[model samples]
Target: MGHPMIQLDNLDLKLSLGRLVLNVLYIKSGFFYHSMPEHRHSNGSYELHYIPSGHGRLIATGREFPLSPGSLYMTGPGIDHEQITDPSDPMFEYCIFFEALPSGRNHHERLYGRSGGDSEDIREIARLFLETPFWIGQDSRQLQHVFEKLAWEINTRSIGYRRNITIQLEQIVIGLVRNYTNNQPTLQTAPLKTLDDKRMVLIENNILYNYKHITIRTLADQLGLSVRQTERAVHKQYGMSLREKLLEARLQEAARLLDTTLLTIGEISEQVGYQSSESFTSHFKKWQGLTPSAYRTRTIVPTIQ
Candidate 1:
């Protein structure tokens, strides 16, 4: 297997939601290509390669693996690797790069963490994915569908497609990683039952139903726990106080409305349970570094342009 020459078309790339990054490469039809030389990524992002139509070979860490249509390969950050495509058959592949964050790190750093699970679980998962040379001869129809959707969004640049594509890619990457993890032996740990686990579900349901009028005392009584106990449970589960989580949920909803709808800032504030525009502006500014009007102006005005 050798690297072949094919026309590479760069599609629109955007950071729509979280810290994840995505790039779609289209190898124009009829371009006979083989091989991507060994390379390393400094940013600690993992690479997920999906081959839709072609055959190839992968060389990584002194090992060679054959590539075929529906081949899926994963390489972690800083790992040098290369792929050799069969020159006879041109193929298309979508490369997804993402960083998995730790539980309590900033959004950006969390994306690059060593693993997506606990340390032990991540070690085993990473080992399995890296050791498995190539997942060839497996049906990759679902993956092909995902790549097609991504390709459509990238080429068309349809209204709101950037956001849609980013989300879809995230789901796709997570699904693939999860599938790999589930097949590994480390994820078979015994489940632990905690009082807060049950209580948090009840609390989340309550908040979803009536976030507008939610109060500490009311939640405490509804959960049949003392206010102090309820508060501790929430903090333990989410690493934030109950009040903070409530406000976060509210702000997240408000941000979505601001981005997707034509709602006025004042109206949006009220919908998210802010009693006063001033209070909402203060809180929004603290979390998002921009007041409601300013944030809307920055995010929505460009769409019109």
Candidate 2:
């Protein structure tokens, strides 16, 4: 709120990962003269800290890591950590608190409708972030610039600032993931032996990201696998038949739309790959124990003035 300190909260910023949304709880950029008390993030939340200048120390789950300019680290869900700033120089810190929310398809699709490698890349990067528990390293991606831009976007609230914030958030996530992975010695020492693993990830991303229009044959063709092979792979990976997999994807997205959007049932039906509202309602009722409209009504939170 004063010089050398800025805190932005309740900003309603979100980053999409097809079905999972990363909601930014708060962001702070300031000189840390006071120490951050020990705390833990539960329910699969995360906090990222970057020290652009000065000095500090992070005590995480009984392990101590010295912090200084360019120090970057992440504390994931259930990690006990605290930050103590060196009073002599007081660390200039950029901290982001965020949590992942798993919803259905419509919200993510509305936020990011793009397909192909871009979407898949975001998915993979997000996966790494979620899977990693803790990492401490120096900046290799010049993430300070991205944080500066994020702060500017929030302060100015200019045209397209929300979109800009989303992009910057994506960059921050990518930077963090890269920092985590690039610093890992095992990732290089034990490289994946085959392209098969990457291809499977691609196939899963394609189905999840393009569930509305993806077909087994088209997906197989795109991935250079025969239709039968694709079907077999899908069943093995998901333990579901091809038709079941598609149906599950469509329903999952439909459920997300019901919870997070005001789209009409018919509109949501089409968006999630149903040819007709009747068919959508029949499948949804069977899957969710309620009609589409009923599910929305049950899940939607009423806004208070």
Q: Whose TM-score is greatest here?
A: 2
Specify the poorest-scoring 10-residue window by lDDT in model 1. Answer: 185-194
Clashing pairs in 2: 104-256, 105-253
Worst window of 10 by summed lDDT in candidate 2: 185-194
What lDDT would candidate 2 get against the real structure? 0.71
Give lDDT tens digits, candidate 2, residues 1-305.
Answer: 22235588756677876555677777888888777645444434567888889987887756778898899988875566667788898888888877666454554453344653347666666556666767888999999889888888878889998898888988898888888778981121111111243344455557556767788888888878999988877665555676886787688678766755689998999888788999999999999899887887774443211
TM-score per candidate: 0.42, 0.55
TM-score of 2: 0.55
Of the candidates shown, which would achieve the greatest lDDT relative to the real structure? 2
RMSD, candidate 1, Å: 18.8
lDDT, model 1 = 0.56
